[model samples]
Target: MKKGSLLFVFILLLSSIAASIGFAQEIGKDKLFVAALGDSITFGYNLQEDKTKPSSQAFPYLINEGNAEVANISFPGWTSSQLLGALSNQETLLALQQADVITLNIGSNDYLQAIGLQELIENQTPIEFTPELQQKIAAASAQLSQNLQNILQTIRQNNQTAPVVFYNMYNPFGASEDPFLLSLHQAGEQITLTVNQQVLNPIAAASGSLLVDTYSAFSGNQAAFIIPGDIHPNAAGHQVLGALADQALASLVPAAPTVEIVFSTTEKTEGPVKVTVTADQDVLEMKWLPGEQTADKFSAAGNVINGNTFDVPENGTYTVYVKTQEQLEAVKTFKIENIVSKEEEEPPAEEEPPVEEPPAEEPPAQEEPPKEEEPAEEQPVTEQPQEETPVNETEKEERTSVKEESTTPVVTVKKNELPDTATAAYNYTAAGAVMIMIGAGTMLFRRRRARVN
Candidate 1:
């Protein structure tokens, strides 16, 4: 595919997604939404700057200024049945659901269509309340009553608290000079009174809707309220209706009661919890119930639970309801599961004594000076006599044995005395052996001399 075609397709896909996900402009949540439903009287038929659009001078638009949003659902020539049918449309249903207030000016077309008033007026025929016309009006009146009931019911199904302005029809031909028109005006006035008193008034009262007295307000002022030669209201007429609608709505809707619930604890724990409730107005009564409940569903009775503090038992969710003296009610709900007991309720056992450590030994004492004491006695010893005769032999044997064992003998020599010999003969014998050796050598020498001679 070409790039241009592909781009166009992508754009179309994005547009479709945006539409599907709701790019439609939204009414501000803070602004009051007023849904206006009726015939051309509420639509501002000839008063529109652009004929295709709803009029800026319409009663719905004049009802409020910057703080409100208006959805003018009225169209040209919409009868009670048509309006009732329109309530099923998506746009109308949405408007009803969002409306904080609604203004209704229907049933005029129902009367006109049934009686063929336009045909009579176009042919310049004189007006007469004939049996056929009376039959048609009566039938229309019955239909209007049923249709009005259904319309209010539908509005409440979508929005429970929005105030409705039920407008009764007016006689627009009262100021006409033409005989036929005057006759038509007189008959219309009677029919208008009958319809308003019998059909609209009772229904509006039963539905708790505000009934705007348009018939009385526009009684003889049709020239000022209605456009010249036209049954639709002029800008001035719409303005007057707007002021009346505003007044009726203010009275119809009571001030919203302010109420609050304060729980002792929002958490789960063991034991009962305390709840306190407060309101800006005088509280007639209050009640406690299991789980959450709306004001309509609050069926608790037999006990007036209103007070400073109420104890809620453990392990469940509960809703508390407060009804003011004005009959308006408010509800608050909370969840809790109390299971654990408080510590102070059960005291702990006494603790054991701590273990003791052994004592340490004392360090050694420093040494002190010695004290004098008596000496121990020694024992006596006995002496033996010495043998003198074998002294030399013993000494000679000792010397020989010592010499046999070892040649050198270790002797202790005192400082003042020489080392004594073991025997005197030992020294004498060593001298004799040395002298005999000398004699033998001299004799041997002499014998050799003689042999030579």
Candidate 2:
């Protein structure tokens, strides 16, 4: 073949492979993934008063600016060291590996620890500024800086280009104005600033990360953002953070994966349909749900045992959706009407026809040679012929010949047409042996190919 012809053929092959293997990939994209890591602020601490799940208004929950998945591992009261420990967890590590955007908020508790303060802001407490406390502050500051550096390194090991946003800590004690408490608050604010500017900011800049200044967002309005006398943000504060994160993530949204479901009737009944969604061989962790449905329909809300296909046995209208790989990507629903169950179907029983009575075998008609007319014998009526003398051997033989001429011929069958059982058994045995040989050959060929691979 000429060089141009070979090149054209190769190009066609490449196109065909891409079309088949990446069926869910639209022109050029996959789902966007966002990973949120750190403390109470990112956890939406006081946003949900009644539930453990984060409020819908939480920043992590609101990070979805497009086709996106969010993994929120934030916990309340977590210090920089605590977060550094959490990075070793398999779930957190896996989420980082797949992240397109990551938000980090830590070291706030470390700052609080530096001052040796409990969870309280007292107005009348006296200040005893000692050298021992100053040493504690310095040590806490050093630990916070090291942990922050390590956290960034751990995340960078898994991902290179994801935009990691570092949230600078906000001071929540502006409402306390007693002389001693006011001085303590000032020191706390300065500690937070030192960590943000000296520890977090430079690394973020060097790593091409975004630094969101939460201090400015809550600086003048700390009482409104923070819960009364508590460090956690309120619902309104969560909203502010969510909006900030959303604005930061506006440019990183990628195209979502789409799935096409092809269905086939499992039986002639057509009520039970087999719904198929293609997936990569390595894919695991799938969640299924009925995305759209009639009120009367039974919902399909669980993982399917089979990899890509599910047998929908309900007789109602619905669309089932599937999410794969930590619920990062999902395709539109696979629609189905009545899917029938094959086991429930039975073919109608056939009625045997009434047997006919065979006609009785008729006796063969007896045919004797028509009686020959006897020659007139007037003398026999008058008198019997004189008795013959005792017959000799030759005369007996003549009498047997006369009797043989008067006997009738009998009919008989020529041959029977019944099948030969031996011949039929031999033919079946030969066919079975041939099939066994073919099957054995096929299995051996498959085993050899497997070994070679």
Candidate 3:
């Protein structure tokens, strides 16, 4: 062959190989493998392990539902420093190789610890204000910001082609007045915002990467998103994250296709209890049997179901059968275990009757004169004056002689039947008796007075 003909053949071969490579790249782009790296919040910490399905509201699960395969490498309490350390490990490198999309959330812990350091310095200082401590805080904040930048740089080095999305730190403490904790939280917020805008955004913009703004979504709403006394997001918070993931993934993937089995729980006894069924897509009609059930029991509060609260009324083996759009069927079984009810325990019955020592013997009784004693003395005095001259001694003698002379009952004079003259005589005798008493009293009083003198 001529030299020009040989060169033309070589050029044609090179063109064909280039076309094939381009087609391969296109095909690879159709599918995605996502990996999440960071702390407990990225792991969906409070979410149940069994319930952490691809349908979960966590961002990874949401991305998977959008047709990407996802893996979560987040551990509780991991900081940017730790995450960078992990990237140097073989396992993390392998994971990075497999990941087409990477979501990173870190640096919050570092910011938190820096705040702790600030507090420690403040406590150690006796002065209310210290310029040295302030300088230290500023230095620490700058270091933290730089550490986050380094983390993003490391990720870029590992996966140059992958679209990296850096999630900004959220304000975990909302509207709190606790100065130390609040200052820490505010510092984290400000530092993260700066890092995202000045560092992460520019890098992403230059490299054609994606940036997911989680900070704005959960900023002031920290109280609503985080579990009380915990650093992790609650169910509703997961839902918010899932929604954001849905939006982010939509830009990268085609609309997702979903098949769900919805059922209402009525008088559930031992499930697999029968449940009413419905479907979003006409793939399968759901049914319940005595022993067979699978696919999660959709809850009223879950992303899918609206009216039913899925519950296992009693412990038993249950299975759910799902029929595909092609009329093919699949079934899965779940064991329902007994859940202990929360109830107050009854206190033990009163052991023995409280021992009662006979009420301490009352002090010996002291006798008290009758309340009517003075009244009784006054009554006798009044009666003596009125009866001063009741019948003379001669009348008394005559009555006794009459009683002796006759066998009949003796006739006694009645004091009440005395005549008017007898009454006048009684009064005169009373006056004489009173005069005598006065004379005796005066004589006694004069003798006492003489002694006193």
Per lDDT, the best of the predicted structures is 1
RMSD of each: 26.6, 37.2, 24.7
**Which ranges of candidate 1 are over 4 A from the true structure?**
1-30, 65-67, 253-453
Q: Which stretches of candidate 3 lie over 4 Å from their true place?
A: 1-31, 48-58, 64-68, 117-158, 176-207, 252-453
Put the candidates in lDDT order, highest first. Answer: 1, 2, 3
What is the TM-score (0 to 1) of candidate 1? 0.51
| Per-residue alpha-carbon lDDT of candidate 1 for residues 83-131, written as tens digits (9 for 90 to 100) | 8888899988998877777788899989888878899999988778889
Q: Model 3: per-residue lDDT, tens digit, 82-162?
A: 777777877777777677667776666665565464455457422222565456546655665556555555555565555
TM-scores for all predictions: 0.51, 0.46, 0.42
- lDDT of candidate 2 over 230-287, digit per residue (tens): 7788877776776776665443443334556677863456455667776542344444
